[model samples]
Target chain A: MAFSTTIRQAYQDELAGLRTAGLFKEERYILGPQGADIEVEFPAGADGRPVINFCANNYLGLSSHPDVVAAARRGLETHGYGLSSVRFICGTQDIHRKLEKRLTEFLETEDTLLFPSCMDANAGCFEAILGEEDVMIADRLVHASIVDGMRLCKAMRDTYKHSDMGHLRDKLIEHQDKRIRMIITDGVFSMDGDLAKLDEIVALAEEYNAMVFLDDSHASGFIGKTGRGTHEHCGVMGKIDVITTTMGKGLGGASGGCVSGRRELVEMCRQRARPYLFSNTVAPMIVAGTLKVLDLVFASTERRDRLEANTSYWRRGLTEMGLDLKQGESPIVPVMLYNAKLAQDMARDLFAEGIYVVGFFFPVVPQGAARIRTQLSAAHTQAHLDKGLAAFRKVAGKYGILGKGKREIMEMYGK
Target chain B: MPIDKQMILDYVIREYLEEDDDTEITYNTELISGGIVDSFSMVSLKRFLEKKYNIQIPDADATPEAFDTVNSIAALVERFVKA
Candidate 1:
């Protein structure tokens, strides 16, 4: 009859089991602004240690940019704080409309509808357009958010092998009986740091007469020649039927997302997407900040070019150090260490050495596919990279994983 | 005289597939969803097959069903192999 015996006890046992399995995730607090370098307080309640950060999605290094901060401040002065209601209510401000317009231009879409986050955009977009007659075939490695979004929709859910156009084509053929077939994928695979091969995907969609849905969250700011997105990068900008992206990562790293694509589809989302209809509107500060971010990215390709160069430099450094890495063109660089314990231990030691990185292992990634995901930014300097590389060498030397790959790591420490 | 399927199976087991007590992988075992070879590893497996067999499996030919088993994988390789 007791609360402890009935509900709390079962939950406690599961939590304890997770801890025993070494799968429990702990939060490391960041004491300062997010950037290439940050002060972190690990294990909590400890003094913040300054470290060169290599695990942030702040790809453009504009999270704390002065101009963005100024723009946000101006927005606060003009528009005030919380919207307290959804966009349909009195929450729709001039700034919000301006941001939507700018985002439409930036993303090269007919229309755009803002969401609380890309997660919301993903959650809301599917049910808004598709129904029981439709089929949503997503890439296997699409982000978890997309999977959840699909689960919420009435459309029958299916998946193709990640970036496998052949599988996608087959799925298209299998589902031709459906009224609508939408191919969904992430513009950039966040964990593996690989691209979605949008060129081939678009070609397949065109051949099958299926619409395409892309979550450009990771590629929104620095992917294309001028930072339009994977659509522009793949030269299929206007052809995509739906694109869901976030301002939380590559934009200003504040928080906001949008579903941008065909005018009718976006309007459908605005009208019926549950999150859009229920959730409070994005803060005015974020709108102004993201607008500035758009201005900065659209003004020039300096940040994108720098990010590409930085990726090359970091990849070269890690490769030369004999650390096995995932082959990728994006800023997400994962240094392979097959064993979970080794990945965690190496990340802990790297933290101690004044370099901040996270160990991704089972549950986060697959078993025997553990690694330390190092994300590069235009904010990262040559000196910062040199220090990070030095720290990596020191930590990898400690673990004896240098020049070792998955097989070697597995041999050294059982998978 | 030609490439053996066991060779491909061994490489797959060694590099990608993780077999359990009841699910030992052989020539006909499903390798994509069944073998638990995730999409990321599938890419690596495709590359391995290409290099080992001296063939380039085009993206369109690298379907989940085609790469579902060692037999299908072998067939795919033979299709692209110079005869």
Candidate 2:
């Protein structure tokens, strides 16, 4: 037994197989700030122009805002770079309290608790709230973090098929006798860019005697009337039982997440959740920057309006180009490419024309449901969007995906 | 005895598989380890069994070893009936 086999190497071999299967995705480095236009490192090409970036989560374009940058500089000067301690210890700075209080006010919740990442927010929420005697009913297409969190919980859990109200009702009725039943879902599905049926979900929760938890990471900073997220989008503000969202995407594009709910629940999570209790406090720079983003969201709707306009323009142009578009009101616009190879090829070809997008296939999405997820930012100008649409149309034609493009797709479908 | 086995099979299939026609499930086979039934479904199944058969399934007994397949689940049910 001195030299026994270790299956650890087998896992890496499997990943190699995935790479050869045309599913291996690697990140490209960005040498500049996140904005509508971004510079991606690639070989020198014709124009040497930066690609029209459509993949960043910088929805508000606050990542490089002068105010946000100034706030970060001030935070560094006042509080330094890192805390080197967790919240309950010496990590609790006065600015952390100020950020939490401000977030509570912004989200209209009694209290808010921050986590290192929204993934942590989701992973820690389940175990902190429910136990073995309780039950959790979640949407099938909720974020991966929620699935992982539910796995950590000892509570009985079941997933209703994505957005199927009938299936959810049946499962809720089946477990109607459980002590605590929580219905959890994402406010907007990140992949399809479609919105959840929140109004319907809320009504169902009331009938099932279940509390609702919404992860609004994708919807928070630029959705709804005041950009208050799905609560505002659905006109159900103050109706949701729990709201969990991130500061990483639309909020400011730095890094942090929070669970906004009743005073007691947030307090309970503060005392128990592993990440909140153990992880280092979020840097004061991120706190101050996110607080500024929130101020912008509240002070004016110009940015949100611009984002909506840009989304509509891109969606309409792509649709007119005879591309398959995922139906939704969200800014995430998925261009369907049922074949994984085709999706990856399209993304590569689009890059040749100075447009950056991400191709998603199986494991991330279901088989025969591959897509190119294009995100629009408020930072983009109409001219930028028009240029992107032109590039997309050119790539689609090259891939044989439009008019005569339909013929090539048919040939592949027959194969 | 045959009626009890059929009942267990029906319950497992109905509880785990949502769309019966589209989804093809093989009964009396290793369900959990094969990834056909996940841990979440297993917990719900345990709750169903406790209510249906009046069997108190302890945390220790709720493992794939005890109830991996329909046959094993039926055996557990029979053992609970006798106990």
Candidate 3:
């Protein structure tokens, strides 16, 4: 008749342990919409601090764009706010199909099936296509969503080193004893911001007669020359067997995801994936706003170009400051602070200097690999970049990590 | 010249695995099974060995069993390096 004290005490003890280890995470409250500049109220009930944001996934800065908002309003007016059923029921609207078709064209895949988020797409895609005799080989550093998706499958799981083709090739060979082999990777690894070696991966897939599955959540609307994603960026457009991407980041910065790839695979997901079969459809307004985002990105690479240029500028600025960074070619730049407390302390100090960045520690990254991950956006102005750099410089100076690299930081903090 | 086993041992204990001044990691110390080295760190350790020796250990040979000890890792590296 009452809640169990045993469970409550167990959780409380675990939480207290986390806080003692400095691994406990505290979330900041945002008083305004998503953007390069936001009002954050931390420690609860504190005054909102106006700061330049460097941690959001709002890569194209379209999260709060006026056009996208108006399109969402229109969608709400036309289709109402909610879909009370799943895709196969009364939920499939004309707008949903339109966005799916648009995504297939945008991603250069044969067909598409929508999901509520990339996590669901990741969870749903594997079980739909693979069987017990198959093997799903993924990168060691692939997203957790993919890992969970693989766990749901009857197929066996093996992992290659991050971006290690030789290792992947070994797995392919070893799993040659199986009926099918699927190579799973993130087109852009969100943490390190490195593009997967897709060209090489595709070449291996062709040679080994394996299918490739990519989760391009971080690179969908702003990666390639035409913003077609990693396939386009890597010259392997039609080669990927299953491509999953999100409309939540670069698309509309709202919420929706899709599995776009071989027509049969997409169709299979639509028919068999449990999430697609059971979950409520993505909201009509999100689909509508995403469609508008598609049009804007497809028309010209203006926003994409801005994001790329900003990434380059930000990367250069951070490098010039002599900060140790994980070298990559994506908009996510992590300022490596090997010590966990040092990272949290730096982030807190940076916030004090009117910059918003979060410290990523163990459980998110590896135990020794703590960092402050900064993201660049098309929404950011040169002024925002300059101020962010200034804040970073001030904080780095305070922590005495300004010019120190990984080895030095680790030595100081005993990683 | 043959690959330096001592360097490999020291690097693994110091870089990949956290070691204090008195932490003793002998050639026979269990690395993976003893929970000192995880799969992710094992990959980085593999990369370090590959880079230092200028030889690639095919992923099949780079298993947890082969990397469970400093001696085992050195012996694995010697095969490729000597070849």
Candidate 4:
């Protein structure tokens, strides 16, 4: 039996609204390795040469690293390409064990468990651990995966008004008698390019007798002096209870994720977590590639150092241009534009100028919080950063956003 | 003793649970797998039961079977008060 005509019309009508509202994402076809410069072929737009990439999450410049590629090739030669089974069912290889151990040691955690993706790691965590009697306090601005995980767990869930320690304290007091309480937050908020106050969270958890869970997907590969993530950045590396991160964004841009914590907690999750227990394991080649990336991260600080330099150069240049960049040290820099249409227009203009950056608007962020989400990479050269900044200034000025310098041009319209 | 089962059900459906306006949930609504109550909704339900009924619900009673419907949640609430 075919569906009713009303059902078909309803779906089509809803999609039409999305198009009219300018919220539909236009996916670009990337034709090169993830790096500072990218080549994209658009089906609709005017054909042009390859544009520079400013939106990738390849923070450490290791996506196509020779060592990482070589390691993946070796794994392919030795263990074959894919593991058809889950981790417990003949999918756990020697490299997986070694990588997990090395991750735990590198993060200074008791144990670690791997997952197919960071999204899975997050979605599997809350349900595996929290019970109905427990209480979970989370930051309001955490990742969508963390929110989904919290939705799947039967714990008393409450969110402290984003990064407000006083509100967090009040919630802790209200749930003081709960069996167990966990404070969950992202190490680096993706959109706003802000770092969570880890010192404050750790201190609050101590006073409230709560466990802490930090999803450091954005900070994992290149934050601290040793690149150990938010905990190391905050100088509380051993205090946090759980650390979840993804290998897709960093660690050679391979697809994998992990959660590191107490051995007992890791064991419990392995047995009970729905996604980890049911899903296929990380491919042998990906695991080997990740291990090599980790080795590179530890051996030399060049990648991280270069990333920091690129971030500062871009941020300082953007700031000097009088653009309102969110104040943070993370590589994710958001150039705020209060109007969604303007942000989209600015992105289109930037594309015309051979720079590729994505504009984020409401629904992704709160309404009126639209901005260009510019991501920096160690792969970005001095010339690349300069070109990107120049493009941004030109586009932003064209929109009358650069202030009195463009005042006469905008006033000519007699608005 | 008389219990306000309607208020209890409404609280569970609106606040403790993520209810859909597209569907109607009677006092005897089954929550789990029916898409009425998820894990987060279950947590909120537990909190509501504890706060409104003034009873502590143990883990054993926190399963989908116990919170299957408004009747089940009410039944669990009743059991908690008795215990």
Q: Model 2, chain B: what is the TM-score?
A: 0.79
Candidate 4, what DockQ?
Answer: 0.07
Residue pairs clashing in model 1 are B31-B68
Instruction: State the lDDT at A3 in candidate 1.
Output: 81
**TM-score of candidate 1 relative to the true fold:** 0.85
- Rank candidates, DockQ, best first: 2, 4, 3, 1
Model 2: pairs clashing at backbone N, Cα or C within 3 Å: A400-A405, A402-A405
TM-score of each: 0.85, 0.86, 0.86, 0.82
Q: Candidate 4's residue-wise lDDT over A277-297, tens digit each?
A: 999999999999999999999
Q: What is the lDDT of residue B35 in candidate 3?
A: 52
Per-residue lDDT tens digits for candidate 3, residues A44-89, read 9999999999999999899999999999999999999998999999
The TM-score of predicted model 2 comes to: 0.86
Complex DockQ per candidate? 0.04, 0.23, 0.07, 0.07
Stretches of candidate 4 above 4 Å error?
A1-6, A44-48, A403-415, B1-83
Each prediction's RMSD to truth? 8.7, 4.4, 6.9, 8.3
lDDT of 2 by residue, A1-415 (tens): 4433566577778899978877666657676788878778754333344788899898887878999888888888898898899989988788888888988887788899989999998998889988998888988778889989888988888877678888789988888889989998999999988888888888888898888899999999888977889888887787787899999999889999999988878988998888898788998888878878877888999998889988998999999989988889989999987777788889888888888998997767865567899998998998889889999888888777774343356467521
Deviation of model 4 at A161, angstroms: 1.4
- Top candidate by DockQ: 2
lDDT of each: 0.88, 0.82, 0.88, 0.83
Docking class of 4: incorrect
lDDT tens digits by residue: candidate 1, B47-69: 67777877878878888988888
